[model samples]
Target: MKNEIIPYILANYPDLQTTKELLIHCHKLGIKYVELGIPFSDPSADGPVIQNAATKACINFNFDNLLAILLDLKKQNINLEITIMTYANPLYIYGISNFYTNFSSANVKGLLVPDIPFEERKVLTRKNHSIKNVWMISDNLPSASLKKIVSNSNFYLYLVAYLGTTGKNIQQSDSLKSTIAQVKKIKDIPVAIGFGIKDKNDVTNILNIADGAIIGTSLIIELDKSLNSAKEFLNNIIL
Candidate 1:
């Protein structure tokens, strides 16, 4: 799979048409891989930026809205490597088998579940080997656990730069550099860095150590501010 700089975006926008338009914006920005966040009532792993977006999305458009967006993406032949970032509760409530089956048919290529324990990964991997469920690891994770976790992951390993929730913060410090260096030595699946990546400098900075960077909170905030002009908003960053 193409492990490029995959920037995340909220899937639960106010309208599906605008969401599609934002996707076109991303494609124009030359970003091939896109992580679309699936909003739930209670997103434990998400920070305030995403939490607010989810709240708005839930009020304006709920689970049915997400399914409709998926269906629309299918019908429009949007053809992008789309990964759904969601918590386990929604999947369990929707029935894992059904979620996989539906998401597979909708052409979703991967999954990201933050709260699922490492020991229970098999619960997801075994459910459907075809679904590329990416696992999360943080800077504090032990080397042994990380090695095992990354080894077991088929898609990608999400490396959290810090322990805090996602939002604006300084770039990953020297300790993060050491951590990335250690992770680089492992050489399992592609290691993608996320959490607290705020600007273009972050893009160039993270590229030095990891295969890709996942920017979520920054993108969400920008998307919110540019609700009326997503293309212009994205161009200001990507260009």
Candidate 2:
């Protein structure tokens, strides 16, 4: 199977229309997965690029509207697997049960709650939600902790490439390679590395070790230029 190239887009960043259009473009490009970031007041895991975009997106973000965008894409037969990435606070305010109901109804495939620790994930999973939980693992995790996280991972494992927030340059160290190897040994789940994955070269390097590469900050930067620019950038990296 071809390695996955998942692009992360902030919901209603520039606007809802553009967000929808970008999803359509991604589908056309043969990209099966897209991370739709829900704007939050405090995005702890996000770097400045995505953080700034989220700040702007929050200005007019409507949770219902975001769901509607997904529903609309479904209506159009766009089958991009959307994983909603957000903090735990927003999920709490929205009510966890209600959040899962709406997202599952809209056909969301996965959920990535970065701020929630492994132990606290039960707070989100207690309801037996249909949407798969995407767990995050980093290079610094202890072997036992990593094993636990990998064993519990539902859809896939999101491996943080570096120790910092998103948008920094990835180092592709031996520790990262060792982490991926360890996860593979623990479980057979697909591991997708993010945080500092910038361009085609970055994606290419990641594909050498992991199952996928998630582009966020760099793609967001291209999107800031134009949708066409974003398309071009993705085209170069996706293969």
Candidate 3:
């Protein structure tokens, strides 16, 4: 697979039109992965940037709205790996069975629920929906737990750049390098890093040990300016 430059977008932020446009722009820029963040009332794991986006997004994001948006993307041929990132509460209330099956049919490739621990996520992974369950990990994971998480994860493992919320600039550390190196030794699948991935320097350093980088807050902060800001960020970061 190509080096995946995945940009995350909180759905219904401002409005869905701008979200769709931004996603299309990403694809046009040669980005193959898109993580669509679902808004929830309590996004505790997120930083202020993502939290604010979620607050506005929650008003317009729902089961029906999500499905509609995915279907729309499919119809428009925005053919990229679409992953849903939401808290467990939204999935449970929406009915896990329906959510997974629907997202699978809608061509969603993965799921990322930062708040749900791997042990208690049986319901989310039980449905045979083919949507990979992405687990979030950091440099501090215990040896046993990290091994288990890497072994249990379906697709790529989400390696957090630092132990913090969605946004914030975290300096590179030997621990982070050691963590990714260890994960690579245990698993053969792609290892993607997120959280604190702010610019070209961040992405460049991360790609040395990771297959991809998951960018959220920084992109959102740019998109907050205008749709073009996302595209600009991608260009600046990659070049």
Error of 1 at 84 (Å): 0.8
Model 2: lowest-lDDT 10 consecutive positions: 120-129
Pairs that collide in candidate 3 are none
Clashing pairs for predicted structure model 1, backbone only: none
The residue-by-residue lDDT of candidate 1 on 1-239, one tens digit each, is: 33466778777565667677777667767877778887766778778888887877766655556666667767887667778888887777777777777777666778888778788875575454366877888778888997787766677777787877777574658877776667667765677788888777887788777788888787777667776455665566566
What root-mean-square deviation over C-alphas does model 2 reach? 1.3
RMSD of 3: 1.5
lDDT of 3 by residue, 112-218 (tens): 99888787767675745688888988887789999999888778888888777878886778887788778878987788888888877778787776788888899
What's the lDDT for residue 239 in model 3? 57
What would the TM-scores of all predictions be? 0.87, 0.96, 0.94
For model 2, how does the per-residue alpha-carbon lDDT over 95-189 read when each residue is reduced to its tens digit? 88888889887769888999987878778875567898898989888889898888988689899998888999899799989998898888788
Measured on C-alpha atoms, candidate 1 has an lDDT of: 0.73
Which residue runs of candidate 1 sit more than 4 Å off their true CA positions?
A: 1-3, 60-64, 127-129
Query: Which predicted model would earn the best TM-score?
Result: 2
